[model samples]
Target chain A: MNASVTARRLPIISLQDVRFSYEGGIEALKGVSLSVARGENVAVVGGNGSGKTTLAKHLNGLLKPSSGRVLVGGEDSSKTSVAMLARTVGYVFQNPDYQLFCTSVEEEVRFGPKNMGFGRDDESALAERALKLMDISHLREQSPVSLSLGDRRKIAIASVLATSPIVLILDEPTTGLDSVESAQLMATLDVLRSEGMTVVLITHDMRLVAQHMDRVVVMSEGSVALDAGVEEAFSDPDRLRRCKLLAPPITVLAQRLQAQGVLPKGAATPLQLVELVARVRGERQ
Target chain B: MMRAFELTKTKVRYPGSDFPALDDVSVGADEGEIVLLLGSNNAGKSTFCRLLNGLVPNSIPAQVGGKAEVLGRDVRRTSVARLATLVGMVFQEPDNQLFCMSVEEEVAFGPENLAIPRAEIIARVEWALEAVGLSGYNARSPSNLSGGEKQRLVIAAALSMRPRLLVLDEPAYALDPAGRLDLYALLRLLRERYGMTIIIAERDAEEMAELCDRVILLRNGRVVADGPPSEVLSDIDEVVAAGVSPPQIAHLSSLLADRFPGKTRPFLTTDDAEKEIADLVRTAGSGAP
Candidate 1:
C-alpha cells in the first residue's frame, strides 16, 4: 500500500491538527483532529463554548483554521472559496432568522439553487422536492418572516436542501422544535442518509444522538475529548462527565441494570431496556 | 383560595389567520407553583405564554377574547409596561431581550425602568446575577457570552423584576445538559425558597416529569390533557398525540406493563423506574437454577 495511493482515499471531511482563535486571541479549537467518512451519520455533541460549532465552521470554509489544515473531498479547505464549497456542503444555521430573508417560503427555497446557477427547471424541481421533504409545501406562498419558529426552521432547512449538497451540517436543528416535528425532521434526514448523504449534527440532545447517529464525537475545552461508536460512547458515564456531558436517562438506567447484574453489560435504548426486562422475567419463570 | 393567575375560556386569533392561536383554554395555578406547558410546534404554547404578560393583544395586536387575570389584575385592563413589573417574561429568542452592554446592566434595566431606588437596583443586580450562577460575569459583554450564558443572563434579568409570576418560553432550549439541569434546579429553588410561581413552556417532559407540579398538554391551540406527571405523562397515546414525548421512564414502564399483565399504570420519573427495576432484577436473580 503506497502512502500516495492511501491519501487518495481520505475521508470525505478531515481536520489535521486544526487550531482556531477568534480575533481577540481567544483559542476556540486547540489542536483538534477529526474526520468523517462518506455517507456517515455522525453527531458532534458538547457543552456550549466547547468548539463544536468552531470545528464545523472550518469544514465549509466559513472560518479558516489559524494553524492547521482542513480537507474536503481530499481537497484543501484553505484553497476553496465558500461559494465553490457550497456545491458539496450545505451548512444550516442554528437560528433560522439568520438565513431566512426572502419574502415567501417558495422564493427562500429557490434562492439557493438559483444562486448556484441551476436552470429555471432544475431550480423549480429542486425547490419543490425540498419543500415536500420538509412538509412545508403549503407554506410556500406565505412569508417566511411571519411563520412560526418551527415553520421557519423547516423553511431554513428546505432552503439548504434545495441546493442538494452531498454533505449536510445542521447546528442544533431540533432545539426549538417539538417532539413530532423533531421526529419528522430526523426521519427526513434518515431517508437522505440512506441515499448517501453525509450528516454532521451539532446538538446537545443526546436522545437524538442515541437514536439517529451511529457515531458520537464529544468535544470539550476546544478539543476532541472522545470519539467512539454510539453504544460505547453512551455506556461510559464517567468519560461523558469529564467532557461536561451526560448520557440520556435510558442509557443511564441500562448502565445501572448492568452494574446490578440484572443483565449483561451493554448499551440499551428505551425499547432495548424493556426487552431485557421481559427476557429476564421469562427466564426466571 | 386566591390564585396567582387564572384564564377561563381564553381564545385568541392573530390578525388575518383562520384558526385561533389559543382556543378556549382554561387553566389556573395557585401561588408558588411550577406549572409546565408542553406541546408541539405551532401548538399555541408560545401564544398562551404571551397572553399571560399581555403581549398578545397589547403589543402584538391580536383579536383576544377571554378573561385573563394575573395576580388579581385583569390582563386586558393592565398596560404592558405596568404588567412588566408584575409578570416577568423571558421570550424564546432571549438574545432579543438583551440590548445592554454588560450582564449587570441588562439585569438592572428591568428594575430601573420601574424607577427603583439606586441602592435597591444595585442590590438587585448582584442578587439576580448570583441567583442564575453568573456572579463573576457582571462586567462581561452580553454579546460575547455563549448561547447558554446569554440564556442565563436573560433569566437574571427576569429575576431582577421580582415579579409575582414568571412566564418562560422554552428557557432551556439553548442550554446544554448541565446548564439545563442548573436551570431546573434554579426554578425549583425559586419555588421552594422564595415562593415564586413559574409557568414554563417546554418541548418535552423528560427530566421535568419529576419536578413540576402539573403537566398541561396542548394540541391545536386547545387544552388536551392536564394532570400530575404520573397520570398525564404515562398516557403515551395522549402525550404523543399532543406532540410531546413522554419521559424515557414512562416509555420503559409502558412496555413493562404490556409485557407483565395486571401491572398498574406507568411511572414517569427515573427514580420510580429505578425502584421498579431493582425489585424486578432481584426477582430474576433469585430464580436462577
Candidate 2:
C-alpha cells in the first residue's frame, strides 16, 4: 500500500507475540504484535471478550501477558512494577467508580502526581492542568460521588492525566457519554495529540474510529484482525458488521446507495456522502 | 384502575436543607401506559421514582404531605413490602441492587422477600430473565456479567416481581450504546407483550421522546411541563434553559431552521426529521417562501 514508515521513528510501545490469560486459563489475548509511536492516536475496536481491555492493562503494566512480551518505552512490561510504569503509561478506566478513590475532585486529580513524588507546587500545577484539560475545574471542591456520571467521568480522566504519562490509554472512552461529553472528550484528546502525546483509545464506536483516530486496530477473538488507516478499515461495512459493529447512519446510507449503483462505490465514509451525491448528479448529467 | 386525587403536593427534604428534594410534584400514569420523567441532575426525578414505590415516607422518612395513591392505596400509609407488588423501582446503578452471587439468586430475592412460594419464585425468575434476554445467564455470577448484561440482569430482577409499574431511573446511563439500545428494546417489549406501565426518569430527550407516550418534565423539584413528547421537546430554548439537552434531531432541526428560514420546524426523532427534511425539499422545489 506504500504506507509511510514515519510511525517507527520513535516507537514508545512494542508488543511481540503478546498473549494473556486470566487466572482461570481463559485466554484473553493471543499472539498480538503492534507498535505505538510517540504521537499516534491508535484506536483498538472489538466486541465483548475480544481482549481490548486486557491489552489496555498490559500497556500500564497492570497485567502481564502470559506467554509473550510487551515493551513500554523499552521497559519490559512483565518485569516493571505498576507503580514504576504509571509515569510512562496512564490508564483511564471505563467506569469512574473504579478509578475514583478520593472524595473531592481536586483530591482525585492530585492523588497521582502526589504519589509520583512531585512537590507541592508541581503537584498542584499538575492537578490544575489536568482539571482544566478535562473541563471540570469548577467542580474542584465538590464531592466526586455527588457529581453526575458525566462529571465523574471527567474527574476520572483528570486523575489519570495528572500523572503526565507519555502514552494515554483509555478503555471504552465514550461508553455511556452523551453527544456533548463525547465531543468534548474527543476534542481534549485532539489537543493532547497536538501536544505530542501518544493516545491509544479502545472503543466499539465506529464513528469515533473514523472521526478521531489516526490508525485503526480491529480485534477479534483475542487477536488483531486489521491494523490500517481509519479510512481503509471502516470502508468495508461487511467486515465491521461481522464484528458486531455498525457505522454511523450517514455512512451506512452512503454505502447502501453506492452498492445499489445509485452512488459511487468510493463514497464509504460519511464525509464523502455529499461528494457521492454530487458525483451521482454529474453522472446523470 | 390506578389513580391519584389532589396529588398536588409531595415533598422530600434532606435534613438541614432549606428546599425539598421533591417539591409540590403531581403526576399520574394510567395502567398499561409508559410515562417518562425528564429533568437535569438533582432535579428530583429519582425522588419522584422513589415516591411511586412508597420508598419516601416508609424507608427514607420524607415529609410526605399530599395524597398519592398506587393501585387504590394511599402511598403514605402503605408499607413498601405491600406496595412492592404494584411498583418496581430500579435505581441508576444496578450494582447497588445486586448483592447476590448468582443471577438466579439476585432475581429471586424480591419474590422471596415477599414470601412467594418457591415454585412461583423460580418461575418468576425464569420469566423475568427471558423478558430481558438473559435467559441463559441464570447461573452466572452478577459480578462476572458485562456492563450491559448487568443492567439487563437488574431489569430481570425487577420484572421477576411482576410489578404493574416499572420505574427505571436512568437505567441506561451506565450502559454502552448497544446496551442502551437493548434496554430500550426490552422496555418496548415490556410495554407491548406484558402491558407493563413503564415510568423512566431520564435525561436523554431523544430516547424518551421515541419511547414514552407522555413525558413529565421537572425543574427545581416542580413539574414544569407534562404532555406528549412532541409537545414537550419541541420547545428547545425552554428545555435548554431547564438545563437539559433537547432531542438530538430537534437540536439539528433548530439549527437547520436558522439556516433554511421558513423551510421546516424541528422534530424530535430522526424519522420525523427525515420526513420534515423531505417535505422541506419538496416545498422549496415547489417555489415556497
Candidate 3:
C-alpha cells in the first residue's frame, strides 16, 4: 500500500497515554491509550465514576487532556477548537435536556448545521434528512420540551447527525429509552456506521454491547482494564469482575452450560445459545 | 388490607391536545405492596404517576375525569400540598428535584416545609439518610455525588416525608448495573423495615419483575395486562409488541418452550433459568431418545 494511503487509513481517533484530571486533583482518566478505526462501532462500559464519560469527551475536544495527546482526524485535539471539531466529531450528552434548547424539533436539528456555518438552504436540507433518519419527521413542528424523554433523545441525536460528523459519540444513549426504542436507535446507528461513520457509545447496558457493538472497552478506576472484541470481552470473567461489569444474561447462561460441558464456548447472545444447544442436541441424536 | 392508592376509569387530556394522555386507566396497590408500571415512552406511565399526587389536575392544566384516590382521599378534590403528606414522588432526573446545598438540607427540606418540629425534622433527616445508606454524606454537596448517589439522596428526601405511598418514575434509569442492584436491595429494605408502599415506573422489566409483587403493562395510555411477572412477562409477544422487552430469562424460556412444548416455564431471574436449563440438559443426557 502507498504510504500516503496507509496514513489516510490510520485510525480516525487516537489517544496516546491520555490523562485527565478535574479541578480538585481528582483524576478521571489515567494514561489511557486507544484507537478507533475509520468505521468501527465500539462500546465503552464501566461502573459509575470509572472515566468512561471523561474518555469520550477527549475524542471530540470537549475536554483537553491533562497530559499526553488525542488526535482526531489525524489533527491534534489540543490545537483544535470544539467548534472546529464539531464538523468531524459530534457528541450527544447523556441527558438530552442538556443539549436540547430549540423551540421546535426541526429548529433543534438545524441548530448544529447552522452553527457550523452552513447556508440556510443547506442547513434546512441537512436538518430534514436527519429528522427523517431519526423517524421524527412528523414531530418537526412540535416543541422538544413537550416531547417525551425518548423523543427528546431522538431530537438530540438528530441534531448532532445534522452536522454529518464522521465520528459520533453518545453517552448512555439508551438510559431512558424503552427496549424497542433502544433497538431502533441502535439500528439507526448501525445504518450510520455502514455509511462510514465511526460510532462510540458509552453505555451500562451489557446486552447492547453484545448485540450491536463490534468491540468493547471496559474501563476501571480511571484506566482501560480490557479492550477486545465483544465476544472476547464478555467471555472473560476476571476482566468483567475487575471492572464491576456483568456479562449479558444470555452470556452468563451460556457460560454455565459451557462449564457443564453441555455446550461449546463463546456463545454470548440468545440466538447463539439457541443455535449451540440445537447443534449439541443434533449430535446427541 | 388497606389500599395505598386506587384509580378507576381515569382519563386525562391536556389543554389543547386531541388525545388524552391517560385513557380509561384503572389500577391500584395495597399497603406495603411493590408495584411496577412498565411501558414505552408516551405510554402514559408518568401521567399515571402524576395523577397519584394531584399533579395532573392540580398543577398542570388537564381535564381529568373518572376517579383517583390516594390514601383514602380523592386526588381530584385534595390539594397538591395536602397530597404531599400522603404520597411522595421521585422523578427521573435527580438534578431537577435537588436544589438544596447539602445532603442533609436536601433531606430535611421536605420535612421542614411540612412544619414538623425542629427536633423531629433533624431526626427524620438522619433516619432518611441512614435508610438510603448515606449516613456520612450529610454535609456533602448534592452536585459532588455520583448519579446513583444523587438518586439515592432523592429517595432519602422522599422518605423523609414519611408518606403512605412512594412513587418513583424511572429512578434507576441512569444507574449502572451495580447501582441498580443496590437500589433494588434498598427498595426491598424499605418494604421490609418501613412497610412502605412503592410504585416504580421502569423499563427494566427483568430486574423489576424480580423485585415487584405485581407488574402492570401499559400501552397508549391503557392497561393491556396486569398480573404477576410470571404470567405477564411470559407473554413475550404481547410485551414486546407494546415496546417493552421481557426478561432475558423469560425470552430464553419462551424459546425453549417453542423447542420443547410444555417442558419449560418462563423465568424471571437467572437462577431459576439456570436450574431449568440444567435439568433439561440432564434429561437430554439420559436415554430418552
Candidate 4:
C-alpha cells in the first residue's frame, strides 16, 4: 500500500462549540470550538477565570459539556467512560500530589499499564521506557512521596506516559520547577513530539510557548479569545493583555526595540533576537 | 535597628534519608527587604522557608543543628504558635492552606484563635482583605474564588496575623502574568509601607529581578551565590551553573555582549534591558538593524 493514505493527518481531539457550567451555575466555558491534529504541540493559556481548566476537563470526560459536543479520537466523549478515554489521552494534573498514590517511583509508573491489563513484562518495559524518557531512572527505587517536587512531577508524567496514550495533556507541569528543570521537561516533550505524540500543554509561562509550542489558544472570560500560530499569537501584545496575559519578557524587549526602529520586527525567542542584533551590528560595520 | 532574623550554620535532615535536606546552610534577610531564593528542586529553598516559620523542627520532626532566630526568638526553642506571630508563610498551593468557607472567616481564623479582641479581629479581617485586593470578596466562598483570588486570600490569612517576616514558596507559579504583577506590587507595598521583611522562593527570574533586593542561590543544600539582584542575577553563567536559569533579559544582554564586546552592559529586568538595547543601537549609528 502507498504511504500517502497512511500519512494523512486527522483531528485527534475535537471540541465542537462546547459549553460548560460548574455546580454553582457558573458558566466556565462559553461556546468553545477547537481541534487538535495528531503529533501537534499546542498551548492553552489564559487568566484564572477564563475556563482553560474547564475546557480541558471535557477532553477526558471529567466534565460533560452543557451544550455542544466533545469528541476524542472521533469518539463521542460523553458516551465513552473516562477510563476508556484514558487509553487514548493521558492527562497529568497541575498538582503532582493529586494523582500520585503509589509507594515507590517504579510502582507508581507501572501501576497505570498494570491496571490497563498489560502483561507484567510489558508493564515493566513500558515503565522503564517512560522513566528513561523523563530522565528519572535513578529515582525508581525511592519513595515518590519523599522526592522533590521536580522529581515527583517527572514521576507523575512518567506514570502517565507508561500507559502509552496517543495524546498527552499536561497542566502547569513546570509550576514548581526551576528554569533548568523546566527546560529539561520541555526538551523531553520535544523528543516525544518528534516521535508522533500529540501534546496539549496548559500553562501560564509564555516563554515555554514562545520557544517550544507551534500553536497557541488564548482563552478569556470563559471564551476562546485568540487562536493562532506562536508568532502571530504573540505579535499583538494588546490583544494578549486584554486576555490577561503578557508576552514573554524577551519578546517584550524585542517589541520595545522594534518600536524604536532599531529592528524591523520583534522576535519570539532569545536566539532569534540575538541573531537579529548580530545582523544589524554586521550591517553597521 | 536590630536584624529581623538571623540563621547561622543550620542543618536539617529528614528521617530515612541518606543526605541532609539542608546541609550547613546559613542565610538571613533584613527587615523591609525582599529576598529572593533561586535554586532547583530539593535545593532546600522550602526547607529554609520552613525554618523561618518554625515548621522545620517544630511542626515537622527533623534532625536540626545550629541556630535559627526570628524576631529575636530562638526558632528551635520557641513554639510554632508564638513564631506564627513573627513569621507568616504563603505556600505554592493555596488550597491546602485555606479551609474556611467564606473569605473573611479564613483571614480571621488565625487572629481569632490567638484570642485577639473582637474589635481588633474585625479591623484585621478588613485590612487583610483590602491588602490583598480582595475587599469585595469577603462574603464569597473560598471555593468559588478564582485561582488568583484564592492566592490573595491565602496571603491575607497570613497577613492577618501581623507577622514581621513573610515567607512565600513559589507563590506566583500558578498565577497569570497579570496576577503575578499584582502579587509583586503587593509585596513591594508590604516591604515599603508595612515594613515587612519578605523571603520568597521562586523559579521565575523575569518577575523576581524587579521585585527583590537580595538574591540567594542554593544548590545541594548549600548557598552558592548570595548578593543583590543586579549583581547576582546579571552573572548568567553563575546563576545557570547554580541550577537556575537567569532572566531572559539578562541572558539576552549577555548574548549581545558576547557578539559585540564592551558594547552591552549587563541588565536583568525588562525595564533595564530596553534602555540598554536602545542605547547600544543609538551608539552603533542606528538606521536599520
**Per-model i-RMS:** 2.3, 5.9, 2.0, 2.4
Judged by DockQ cut-offs, the docking class of candidate 3 is medium
Error of 1 at B190 (Å): 1.5
Question: Which residue pairs of candidate 1 clash?
Answer: none
Whichever of 2 and 4 has more DockQ, that candidate is 4
lDDT of 4 by residue, B44-137 (tens): 8898889889998898989988887887788899999999988999999888888988998999999999999999999999999888888978
User: Candidate 4 chain A — worst ten consecutive residues by lDDT sum?
Assistant: A1-10
lDDT of 2 at B60: 78
lDDT of each: 0.85, 0.78, 0.87, 0.86
Cα lDDT of model 3 by residue, A18-53, tens digit: 999999999999999998878778899999889999
For model 4, the superposed segments whose C-alpha errors exceed 4 Å read A1-9, A83-87, A97-132, A136-148, A162-164, A264-266, B15-17, B278-289
Enumerate residue pairs that collide in model 4: none
Q: Considering TM-score, which of the candidate structures 2 and 4 is the better prediction for this target?
A: 4
Report the poorest 10 consecutive residues by lDDT, candidate 1 chain B: B260-269
User: What stretches of model 1 exceed 4 Å from their correct place?
Assistant: A1-10, A97-164, A264-268, A280-285, B281-289
Clashes of each: 0, 0, 0, 0
lDDT of 1 by residue, A1-285 (tens): 232443465478889999999999999999998888777788999988899999889988899999999988777889998888878889999999999998999999999999999999999999999999889999999999888777898899899999988789999998777787788888988988888889999999898898788788899999998887787888888788777688999888777777777765544567778777777777776
TM-score of every candidate relative to the true structure? 0.89, 0.81, 0.89, 0.89
**lDDT (10s digit) by residue, model 2, range B178-231:** 566677888999999988888898866755667788888888888888898888
